[model samples]
Target chain A: DAGITQSPRHKVTETGTPVTLRCHQTENHRYMYWYRQDPGHGLRLIHYSYGVKDTDKGEVSDGYSVSRSKTEDFLLTLESATSSQTSVYFCAVSAGVSTDTQYFGPGTRLTVL
Target chain B: AQSVAQPEDQVNVAEGNPLTVKCTYSVSGNPYLFWYVQYPNRGLQFLLKYITGDNLVKGSYGFEAEFNKSQTSFHLKKPSALVSDSALYFCAVRVLGGNKLTFGTGTQLKVEL
Candidate 1:
């Protein structure tokens, strides 16, 4: 309910294909984060951007990439999808770092076959 | 590096019964702890956070958490349980000057009537 939306709420694509999930926010927050939620793994950070064009890798950013060309949009792209990459992806925005409250979008459930 | 642990994979409680979810954290600096709740098919929602204040932190939806620096734990508790409270709970941690967060594996709360 934080004016955050994720495109393609559900997606199913074959392995080795390219896939992108978009997170758009209207909150004007400075920090945007991408996280993946898997069973038994809770939620792990995939990538995050502090500002436009300033992104950094997270704990689980091995096969994922992110970009923030503008303040409102944060995109998570899978260069070449793999079966292991299938998971529920969530995007969150925070006013600032250091324990600022984070607001999350609904989610994107991705399946790789 | 900062990390949090949720010992229970699942917790069961009867309606009107007191409920508690355990969380312990490890951080290099003063820890900033947070609790989030996730319903099925939805995104994570912030419940409460402990920054630099009283050890007892109260949050939304009749939830409260106690921060114990000696034990490095921040446990979530509610005086009474509700069937609607059934969801997955996550505990996350961040250092004083860190922008990234580390989350626990999540505990599933089943508040049964």
Candidate 2:
């Protein structure tokens, strides 16, 4: 376990509501990533942060946003939840090296109706 | 763009039988391959990775993967399967200097008694 924890392990909300999931790591890793897992789609990266205040979009960045103000915390927000955004969201962290393997959090299951 | 493919939607194997999960990737430069496993309701756990080294790499939980550049494949294999090995397996690829990983759709492994 990479000392990663995700808040709100499960959530259910109506469509068009705002949702924010938090990922906290005690490892102080330099790279943090957010991914959503859905049936038949595996895990798709939502967003990632290389360092404090530096972020980049991933393959499935739409409808989601991320911010990392500190090394140990990364946040993923759904500005307006949609039914299509219902999925298991996982947070991961790495040492930011090419050979390093990323460790994951326990994951949060969000459902939008 | 880097990409990964897992041809099988699911794989079934009996306990004590040899098992393999297929994975293939396409990348521009040298690729960094990875395998992850996710139990029901849990986040993905790192199994092993191939950065640069021998063709075979051992990982957690008595798992190992063979990297074949000729086939552009990094297949996950175990000599004998266990019931606890039943889970969703994912393959991912990242090219040199690329910060994000592209993942496959995932393969569900079912180990039966």
Candidate 3:
């Protein structure tokens, strides 16, 4: 367990409502990532941050947004929740070295109805 | 693009029996492979990774994965299965010069008592 924590371990929200998930890390890693896990999809990268404010979009960044204003926190926000966005969200941190391993947070289970 | 594939959806083994979960990968340059496990309602936990070095990589909880460049495979193996080992396993590969990882659909392992 790398010192990582995700807020709101479980959440249930209505469709079209805004939702936000938080990931906090104790280790000041240079890279942070947000991923969503589904039954058959394993996990899909939603967004990533290289520095405090430098972020990039991932393959599945479409209905999601991320912000990293500080080294310890990375936030993922869903502008308007949809049923398809219902999944387990995980936050991971890496040292930014090539071939480095990532440490994951506990995860947040979100369901949109 | 780097990608991983877990051919089996589920694997069943009795306690004390040897178990294996297959994983294949495709990448342009040398592949950085990883194995992770997820318990029900929990986040993904890092098991092992093959950055560079020996092909036989040992991981946590009596698990090991062999990297075969010729076959583009990194199959996870265990000498003996335990009921506590039952969980979902995922295979992942990171693209060259990129920090993002692509994961497979995942394989569920059931070790019966």
Candidate 4:
């Protein structure tokens, strides 16, 4: 298993509230990614960072934002949480040497009421 | 756009029986295919990948996948199934030179005792 950890294993928040999920990795990987897993949708990329301060939006980046100020931490924030944002969020890190393999964090389950 | 499909939502096999999970992909250029397994309450774990080498690629936990260029399929297979193998399996694909991956809806494999 990779040295990746996600904070707040589970959370329940009301609509219009702000939620933040954190992902930390001890692997010191260069590439980090945030993804959401929902029913009927396997896993969709929300945002990814190739390096510190270098990030890009993904297919489902409409309501989510990510930041990677350092190599060990990647944070995903929901500006104003909505019911549609209820899903399992996952963080992954890749060494870039082999893009084929990515190590993932345990995941965070968020529920919006 | 690159995409992956796992036709079955679930698969069942008794212990000692052979197991197979189907996956097909669509990509413009050469595809980098991968298989991952996820246990309950856990993140995705890398299983195997097909980069540019042999068509038959073996991975962890006695699992192997065959890359068929003509069919654009990378189906995972195991000669003997174990009850411990019961979990959710995901198929993913990345287009050449693309860092992002598109994943399938996932197939839940139930290896019965």
Best TM-score among the predictions, by candidate number: 1
- Judged by DockQ cut-offs, the docking class of candidate 1 is high
Predicted candidate 1 versus true structure: per-residue lDDT over B22-110, tens digit per residue:
99998887999999999988999999999997999999999999999999999999999999999999999988768888899999999
**CA deviation > 4 Å runs, candidate 3:** none
- Score chain A of each prediction against the true chain A by TM-score and list the results: 0.98, 0.98, 0.98, 0.96
TM-score of every model versus the real structure: 0.98, 0.97, 0.98, 0.98
Question: In DockQ terms, which candidate is top?
Answer: 1
In angstroms, how far off is B88's CA in candidate 3? Answer: 0.4
Q: What is the C-alpha RMSD of each candidate to the true structure, in Å?
A: 0.8, 0.9, 0.9, 1.0
Clashes of each: 0, 0, 0, 0
Report the CA-based lDDT of candidate 2 relative to the real structure.
Answer: 0.93
Q: Candidate 2 on B1-113: residue-level lDDT in tens? A: 78899999999999999999999999998999999998987888899999998999999999999999999999999999999999999999887777888899999999999
Give the range where candidate 4 chain B is weakest over 10 consecutive residues by summed lDDT: B93-102
Q: Kindly report which residue stretches of model 4 are placed more than 4 angstroms away from their true locations once superposed.
A: none
Q: Give DockQ per model, in order.
A: 0.85, 0.75, 0.75, 0.67
lDDT of 3 by residue, B1-113 (tens): 77889999999999999999999999898888999999987788999999989999999999999999999999999999999999999999986688789999999999998
Evaluate residue B48 in candidate 1 and report its C-alpha lDDT on the 0 to 100 scale: 97
Pairs with steric clashes in candidate 2? none
The alpha-carbon lDDT assigned to residue A48 of candidate 1 equals 96
lDDT score for residue B2 of model 1: 74
